[model samples]
Target: MSFINFNFEPSLQEGLDAMGFDRPTPIQEMAIPVIMQGKDLIACAQTGTGKTAAFVLPILNKISKSGSNKLNTLILAPTRELAIQIDQQIQGFSYFLGVSSVPIYGGGDGIVWEQQKKALETGAEIVVATPGRLIALLAGGKMDLSTLEHLVLDEADRMMDMGFSDDILKIVNYLPQKRQTVLFSATMPPKIRQFSMKFLHNPEEISLSIGKTAEGVTQSMYSVYDGQKEELVRHILSQKAYESVIIFASTKDKVKALYKVLRKEFDIEAFHSDLEQLEREKIMSNFKNKAVKILIGTDIISRGIDVVGIELIINYDTPSDPEDYVHRVGRTARADKEGEAITFVNPKDQHKFVRIESLIGMEITRNPMPEGFERGPEYLGEKAKSSGFSSGGDGKSKNKKKKKPGNKPAGEKRNSESGFKPRADFKNAPPAHKQEAPKQEAKKTEPSDTPKSETPSKYGQRKNVIDS
Candidate 1:
């Protein structure tokens, strides 16, 4: 049915029409009616399911009916990016309804603080904020929520993951007790169920696609050595079908490094917590507009980003948490469009693969690396060699060196300088910078001990003695 069939205000309908959204998503269709009736709700839906609109629409409807635009709603989100995104969507849907909205989050200039203070002073219709900043403002007496008629915990699971349960409780203390509460999440862990019980009053549960990946996403994995991951990613990008890829790395440092590498080798950008707010916004906007071909990101982008037409998602490294894997791959295949998710799995991360397999309840088909792509492990070895560093047994620096046989001599030693006996290994060990020298000295000192006849060591001979 059309959005008009939901009987939204003409102004809201006009805004929806302008945005080309004619019909409600399944979650919205099922949730909006129940929410408009002022029932508490616990909604389980994947990202890109238009779940935001489900709650926002009914909240706006309630505000319109009450004719109150004075701090009547508070939507708490887990991240600055998500807070801003939800604020933007609220503005979009309520453009003609005169709903004043402000996003209060950290990292923006003091200007956000000023804007937030001013909005609260002048009675904003809705306030969307990250829990920390909003709670701080409320505690500092900069904002009041006593008139709040609705409370929304957007991305509730993420909030719980972010350790915001205490903050949520603190914020809820200021909210009116008889108000509607809505909790939305991509997955429903037991903690989330507990959280709902604590906050919601016999909430109506709405679940769409529970314990499943988005149907539109085509999931696959490439089995390659760690050394080939980067080249394999590049080769995948070279394919005509691969456009606007979001590559997920496991760490912030990797995100920055990968972004730098991709920027040098191809047209790409990176998003992570380390970026300045403006830089992050710029990268997100450019990527959204198709000005950038690739985005190297960490889990920061996994929860809130809603860019459309993302052709593929590349897991540059396997996600440590299976839920993060779900969110990362969910970035693509949005709005009913078919998309692809390719994960790069090296042998070192087999346990992680098993965890993901168990979580998703499906095998990630192993595909061969693209032809001409070099393996990552071998490439790192060659790189180390080229840089005059030896790739030791563990593929790290050889200069670090292993312990010599007689460094401790089976006894501890006393340090006269400190008047205390140190461990024999410590007493005989060279200084940090002299570690390499000991290796050469040990080689020379041990040559005579080498058994030319391949005789066993004393421990091996002792085994025969014991047996006799």
Candidate 2:
């Protein structure tokens, strides 16, 4: 439906019109009405489903209507990348509305910390912060939240996974119990529901497309050994000149190694958890501007990145958690645009990939290993699925939300008993739609054009990149 139906304040409406946001996404359509009514809510939707705007739009509208304009809303995010991203969306959405926000995340030096502290102590109607640094600010018991009318827990499930449950609860203790609370997660595991119950008062619940990949994502995989993964990455990059690509591995070492190997032939950067905040931001700026064409990082970035026109996502290492596979693939095919995802599955990761397959209820087309490489594994198939692998990643146990039945596309089958299956021939999913890179002159990255890493707003904003 058109955004005009929401009847937002004129200033907010002006911002939406200027930004060219005329229609609402399904998630936004369902959640915005509930939020505008000033009700607490628990929303679960896949990444890139406009989850951020679902709440941000209503919150901005309410702020415009009330005109309090002072520490009215507090949003907690799992990572600095996300905090910055949410703050940016607020910036864009509130441009004409005159709503000011401060992003408080850690990893910044003294100057940044002081700047954030001043903003928190003085003004800014909305504060989007990471749990750790916010907790640090609250430790002095000087930061006040008694005036907070709204509390948002964006990417709620990711916070739980990062062991921020206690920190979040502590922060909640500082907020007004009478405030409206909104919790948004990509998944609704039991723990998240329990967490919600503790604070969100009789919240309105909305869940959509759980455990399903985006419709526009063309999914595929390559079976390879550890020794053969580098060559495979090279071959894939050579085969197609994807303008913007993200390669996800499990560790910083892997990201760095891949960057070293591919730098000369391709304009690429490695994004892990090791770079300083400025270094990270500079890399991200370059990547978004198309100064660098490739980004390599870990699971930390999957949900935080929201750049449009991303043509490919390559999993350099198999993500052990099935849901992670969903997030990684979600990186591409955003904004209802076609894109592709290719996973490199080594023999050791076969069972993990099997869990992924079962979760999505489809078989990904496994391309033959390039001409001369040895075949990776037997792909134990159903046997491996039953061979006692935990659905969570590694030794960590994630409380996976049971797959809810999602609406399948036309010509796709709905498996009522399990999850919805897109089609038996997902193996033959078509290549992503072609879009040439932005024609800007290439800007060279510093440090001899070598090792690195970096998120944004249209359905152009969400994500962070780092090196560890």
Candidate 3:
């Protein structure tokens, strides 16, 4: 329960004390021992569960215990932000222990590249890097991992999702086969398990709150039309007094648009893949420093960027994948702190939210739409589920293969099904062959039930008689 129980080195203990990390989270509690024992591990934990420290602390302790200061650990992250984040956490955990690390990622200047190259060549005890940049460095034949004793793939699922598995395998080719491999992921999908099988040799697996959001987060959703989403977001932001907020849009365009709308009204910033790495870092720094109250971004900031005390998370666009919903909300309620996550569900995305609720094992509270906006769509969770692709926008069945008029089933009446009956005269009309009479000049047929004084025009307008 307590970090002291691990009996880490005095320096590590002092660093933990300084960081106020006295208690080990569930993932850390379960994962640290397995990792310290020099066993391969596969840990399933959600974001904000102190997963960074789970592996970082144990690796630092092992390195210190071995009295080896050479490169001993290689941590691969999914994104540059996450790589930097892991390096920062490593620094905090190894503050008094004197463990050195350099974050290897792209988008930095030539000076930063030279610095990374120097660090890799001169050897840091631990090197945290993104797979792509690390592969590039490895190909250049300037870095060395032959002395590596530990290999960690943090956020392993994300790495695969971002298409880094090939690079990871290539990087693994450079490592020694005797080293310990530890994989930590928010969710363990089949792909992750399969990937882990190749690298981890009979690894110990641990799982916690799989496919679910944190308990401290109060989850709710608002049903709104696409046109009213911005108004709804503005309403939510204005209605509450949140200290820090993150708005997750699905696309960079959406993030830009929301940032444009909210920047004039509040202290806000936008983060997306389009922005330069420096700009993204600056925005994140401002957000973490409380200079920016609202941070709107795509899923890029959903997992890697961990800012504590985030009071609110707004899903400006509902994530189609349920796992993403978990990560977006996980941005808040971190470190056992209570937070709120509000999601805006449009009609097309309503089904996706339903899937998220199912995956998380709870029904999200449906908030009432604010006044002055059009009514939101009905909750189509069950209807759309039971009848897949059956209903169209107007709620009509899209049965393109309708039965022909003559192909009606036996005893099925046409009028009863179609709501209309053919004229009775057609029932007794002569057969086609007998009705083919001689052709003649066109003549107007008189209405059987109309008065003679009234005449119907070609357009069906009637003319009145003068005497009438």
Candidate 4:
């Protein structure tokens, strides 16, 4: 339906017009009216369905009409990436109105802390913050939200996953008990439903199907040995000279390790906890601006990043969580545009991939192993064996004749780092820099480890967000 049906204020309508936002998305259509009616809501919508605008629009409209800007609303997000994104959207959607917002997150320069404190001390209609940083501010008594009119929990499931439940409950305790509370998430696990009872007041529940991937995504998979991963990455990126690509790796160490190896061959950067806050922001800005073509990062960016026109997403590593697969793949094929998502599944992660397949309700096209590479596992589903860092495996290690016990003193425990063996080349990769590390986020001080960035879901069935 058209946005006009919402009867948004003239100023609000002007902002939507200036931004070319005409019709409402399904979630927006369902939620705007509930939020406008002052009813609490719990919405389940996946990434890339215009969920941001769903809550942002009505809140802005209501806050604008109220005319009093005394810390009217507080939005809690899981990451700094999402907090910034939501605040930016607030600015865009409230352009013609008097709504003001401040994003409270940590890890930036001291100047950022000062800016957040000042904005809250004076006046802001809305405040979007991460749990950790917001707690810091509240502990310091930096802002008074006793007059707060609304509270929103965006990416509710993610915040719960990232260990923010306690912090969220604490933050809520500071807000007025009578305020309108809204919750939005991509999934509704048992925990989410149980947690809502604590705060929601007869909240209206809206669930659009869960684990549903977008139609435009073209999804595919590859079963390769551990050593074959880097080679597969090169092959995929080379196949279509992708202008904008994201490689999802697991941890900060992995992100850095991958960046070092791929730097000379492509325009790439690493996004992880190691970089300075400004550097992270700069890298994200470059990606959105198309100056940086390839971004490799951990799940830190899995929920909130929203860069459209992303051409490719390579799950340099598969995610343990099936829902994350949806988020990573959702990055591509956004806004009804087509995109591709490719995943690399080693023997150890084959079962995880299988669960993802089940969650999405379809088997992904399995691309054959490249000509020179060794043949991979035989699609063994949950029976897939987890292998060590071996160069070649026919995926039948379980059938091999049991090897005689290794030479060792009787009853002597395996050395401290037993199963954690690494390739000789990457053995010293992580520790080499960690031992000599400078103290802080110097932007380059990093200890590289094994890689794992699995971009979030969107469609032609491939690509990335912290919230995209």
Candidate 5:
């Protein structure tokens, strides 16, 4: 049905018209009515499913009906990015309603707090914040929530994952005991269910496409050796179809490395916890403007970033956690646009791929490696030996002999002929046993460096380049 069917205020309708949102998403269609009836809600939907609007619309309606300009609503989000995003949505929906909303989170100047204090002083209607910063402000006697009429936990599972349960409970304790409570999560793990039971009062439960990837996204995986992931990533970027892409890696180092490699050919940016607040904002702004064509980041950018027109998401490294795979892919195919999610599956990470497929209830099609894309020797078989460096396995590397305590003496041993040498004390130490020849060591090379000297250069020169 059309948004007009929802009977929203003219102001909100105008804002929707401006945003070109003609209708409600499934979650919104099911949730807005129940929420408008003032019932608590527990919603389960994947990211990019209009979950934010589900609650924001109803909250705006309630505020408009009551016309109580006091601090009537509190929305707690897991990250600063999410907090800001929800706040922006609230502002968008309440654009003409004269409902004041403030977003409070870390990394911004205390200027936000000053604005929050002023808004509270002048009767702000909604306050969106990260739990930690919100609770701190409340405890410091700078903010009051006694008159709070509604409470919303956005991305509840992510909050728990980020260790905000205690802060959430504390924040709840500070709010009025009888306020309307709502919880939304991409996935409802047992912990989320437990939290919902503790907080919500006879909540209306809505599950839309539970544990599934967004329908608009085209999901696929590539089977490549672990060593050749960089090569595959480069090949994918070489295609002109992807206007903007976000590549997710499992670790900060990997994010930086991928960003460095991609930046050589395209405008690329990196986002991770290590970046300062200003730097992160700058990078995000650049990415949204398409000044940066590729963004290599950790899971931080997966959930809350609401940038539109992202054409593809590349999982340079398959997420070890199955839930993260969903979030990473969710970055694309947002709203109604079609998007593609390509994952690089090394042989050893097949189990993780299986777990993701099982959770999402769909097999990610395995396509042949792109032409000229080299699969490393390690990925030749169905299952490769664990790399041991990060995979936590002891194979050939662990089987190597350990030097005996007395095998080599403490001081330098002068040889009879040579000036200095390793003492040949093993003569009587043990029998001369046949040992397998040592495996050839893979060259110690940076990911940004050319795997082969003749590989075409994305950068001007064919010189060795180190990953950041």
Candidate 6:
């Protein structure tokens, strides 16, 4: 269906036209009207399914009609990357309209914090934030959400995975009990369902293509030993068939290692939480502007980052979560364009890869190892005990075992910070800096003995607002 059929505010229709958005995807087609009616909604749709517009467009139209200057909407995202992405889209979608929004996330300088404070005080109409940063701001007594009318939780499942449940419930205390709530996530696990029930009052539900990848994406896998993995990556990049590529590594250390090796050969950059916030923004802009062709990062970039025309995605390491495998590959094959996703699986990860295949309901084609490379260890699915941060036996929590650094050949040493081993003869290599202390991987569930949050739940009972 075309967006024009919705008959949105003429100003909003103008913004849609400027965005080249003529037709609505299934999610948008089903979700936009419900949200326009100010009904609470829970939508399950995969990444790259145009879910952002499904909510953003309707909200902009409503805000435009009411013409209120006070903050009217609050959106909480799982990561700073997603928060920034959403803020940018809001800017584009509300171009013809007068809606304004400010992105609130950590890893920014004091000046940015003050600017956000000003936006909040001056009535920016919309606020997009990360849970932790928003909570921090709330504690500082600088912002108010008492007038917020719409609440959106994008990637709600990921928000829970990042241990933001209590943070979210805390944020709810500042909101009006009668506000409209909208949640959109890629997967609908039991936990997500419970979360929706806690906040939404008989929300209308919509699910489309859940746990399935876009048809335009061609998925494949290569089995290689740990040692030959680098060689395999080099071989693929040598083909030069893809113009833009994103490599997903398992950790920040792995991302740095891949970036160091690939930087000299291709225009590549690395992204992780450790980098300064402005540096990350510059890197993403460079990647989007085609100044950088290959971008490598961790699962943090796996969802809600929109870079158009990306032709290839290389998974340097398999994700333990089957759903994550979906998000990583979904980065490409977007906007109905054909793209390719390749996953590298070693002996220990074969079991996890199999689970991904099961979730997608299809076996990814196995590419034969290139000639002249040594054969990798056999895939011993059940017998292979995963080591070093492999998810639990069921693939849920992080492995608690301390990791030992891998051994290297004499004279070729790995930098503990970047995990990159330079050739002994490279004289111009940058000196490695000390690695920052690792942030808490994921917050444990609230301790039972801890005092209950001083913030009280305003909505002790849900009033169904879905018009029959």
lDDT scores in order: 0.72, 0.77, 0.78, 0.77, 0.73, 0.78
Q: Which of the two candidates, 5 or 6, achieves a greater TM-score against the reference?
A: 6
> Estimated TM-score per prediction?
0.79, 0.82, 0.82, 0.83, 0.79, 0.82
Number of the predicted model whose TM-score against the real structure is largest: 4
Tell me each candidate's RMSD, in Å, in order.
22.1, 12.7, 25.6, 10.7, 16.3, 10.6
User: How does candidate 6 score on lDDT?
Assistant: 0.78
Q: Model 4, range 1-468, lDDT digits (tens) per residue?
A: 899999999988988998898888788999999999999999998788889898888988887787775678899999888988998788788777756777778775555566667667666778889899899999998878889888999999999998999998899888888899999999899999999889999999999868877788899998776566765676566555567888999778878888876664566778988776666778889999987778899888778999889888889888999999989988887787888888988777887888898999998999987644456656666566453535344343331111234623423312222221122231113233543777463545332211122553222111111112
Candidate 4 yields a Cα-based lDDT of 0.77
List residue ranges in candidate 3 displaced over 4 A. 386-468
Looking at model 6, residue 429 earns an lDDT score of 29
Ten residues in a row with the worst lDDT in model 3?
458-467
Q: What is the per-residue lDDT of model 1 for residues 1-468, given as tens digits with 9 covering 90 to 100?
A: 888877877766877898899878999999999998889999998788999999998888777667775778889999887887897788777766766777777764555456556656766778888898887798888877777888999999999998999999988888889999999999899999987798789999998876567888889886555555655565566555344789999898888777655553466677776656766777787888877767888899998898989988999888878888889988998899889999886545555666777777787776754433332332231123234323322322221112343434323311232122222221122234533444332121111110122444222211111111
Worst 10 residues of 2 by lDDT: 459-468
Q: What's model 6's TM-score?
A: 0.82
**Native RMSD of candidate 4 (Å):** 10.7
Candidate 5 weakest lDDT stretch, 10 residues: 459-468
lDDT score for candidate 3 against the true structure: 0.78
